[model samples]
Target: MDNHDLVALSERRQHQVDGVLTAFFRESHYRAKALGTPYATLWETLERNATGGKRFRPRMVMAAYEALGGEEPERAAYVGAAFELLHTALIVHDDVIDRDFMRRGGLNVSGSYRDIATTAGIPLPVAEHRGMSVAIIAGDLALFNAYRLIDRSGVEGALRTRLHDILDEAMFVSAAGELLDVDFALRQRPPSVDEVVEMERLKTAGYSFEGPLRAGAVLALASAEAEEALAGFGRNIGIAYQIVDDLLGVFGDERDTGKTTVGDLREGKSTVLFAHAVGTPEWAEVSDWFGSPELSVEQAQRIREVLEAAGSRRFAEALARDFANRAWESLTSEALPDAVREEFRPVVASVLGRVR
Candidate 1:
């Protein structure tokens, strides 16, 4: 299909997934209401946090399923919705870990609850703890609903089993990756660039790209060869995506990305950029400000300047481009149908040029 047709197709698939999500949230809200007002409010907060984004995971699923000639668009959408829920689950938990209160330029689950508590005259420490507790339950609910969506999807027998397995692998590997990330940040010794890259792959790549693509292929009943090729493509592209995310976290416009550019710096995230900058004269100059919870905007800008001067920014950009190129190469595999290649061509382009 041409670019215009591809865009239209993606829109249609996204619409289908959105409809499924709306129904899922509606049903979940009612179920929670049966429990109590507080339970219902939690579901409402989750719904607010979950909806509205690029909906990229669902799009990835539909892309592979349709490209490989899967017959059931509706069923595929259910599977796609499952992945989106998983994404929400991970991010909600991640925000608690990062001590973040904002997402997409608005109050997140924890932030929302924390504000409500403070508004009611609760103590700061108690309010913060209450917010974190609510967010943890919210994340758990999202995670559970992710699996429930897949099980309720009309797919049966081995297909369903395989789908569950793929989701299981995503959750398992992602947990390991999150642990690695926390470990890296806490350790006195800095992580190597290669180790940072590996951490990115495990944290974001598995679920965000590979699992979605592979799930689509399985839904389509594509050959093992085709599945493996698509998995490689997803992995490379996912790594590249996360690297760009790191860059964006440090330098991109907050208005465009709907996130703070300095959160990573404040948290002392062990990214590839940090790995390259560690031990440099420039880093030593501003190292004291790197992980300060009270980090200022001026301090962040100074750090950004130092990173740019030290070529850490250029290094990360180059690494991202390298991975994007590898993702393109993965498309050349004969196992992938020509239509599949065409579908992903724009995905690579978007990853390389994305501003948010």
Candidate 2:
């Protein structure tokens, strides 16, 4: 399909997926209302949090399914919604872990709750605890609902089993990746660039890219060869996506990205840039500010300057391009239908082109 047609197709598929999600959230809100005020509030916050995303995961599922000649668009839309729920689950948990209170340029679930508590005269520490507890519950609900959506998606027998396996592996590998990220932050020694890359692959790629693509391919009953080829392409592109994300975390505008650029620096995130900056003279100059909670704007700018001077930014950009190249190469595999390959070209381009 041409670019115009592709954009139209994506919009239609996304609309289908959005319909499923809207119904899911509506049902959830009623269920929560039947329980209590707190439950209703939680569901309401989660519903809000789930909206306003790029909805990229659902789009990926639809793209792969249609490209591989899947017949059931509605069923695919349900599965696509499942992946978007998974994205919500992971990010809600990630915000708690990262101590972030904002998402999509506004107060997140935890932040909203925390604010409510403080406004009601609750102690700061207690309010923070309450917020985190509510966020944890929200994340768990999202995760469980993701599985529930898939189970009810009307795919039977082996196909259903394979889809669950894909979800299982995605969660499993992602948990390991999260642990590595936390561990790297606490450890005195910084991780190697290779280790950081692997961490990014496990944390972001498995679920965000590979699992979604492979799940769609499997749902379509694509051959094993074709499935693996698409999965590989996803892995490469996902890694590139995360690397650029890290770059944006440090360098992009908060207004545009809807996130604080200095959060990674203050959190001392062991990103690829940090790995490259280790042992560099420029990094040493601003190393003291790396993880300080009181890290100021001036300090952040200085660190950015040092990172630029150290060529860490350059290294990360090159690494991202390299992975994008690998993704493009994966599309060339004979196992992938030409239509499937063509569908993903702009996807790879978007990854390379994303500023946020």
Residue 356 C-alpha lDDT in model 1: 26
User: In model 2, which regions exceed 4 Å deviation?
Assistant: 354-356
TM-score of each model, in listed order: 0.96, 0.96
Report the number of clashing residue pairs per model: 0, 0
Query: How much lDDT does candidate 1 score?
Result: 0.90
Pairs that collide, model 2: none
Off by over 4 Å in 1: 354-356
TM-score of 2: 0.96
What is candidate 1's lDDT per residue for 130-228, written digit by digit as tens?
Answer: 898899999999999898888767889999999999999988999999999889878889999999999999988999999999999999999999999
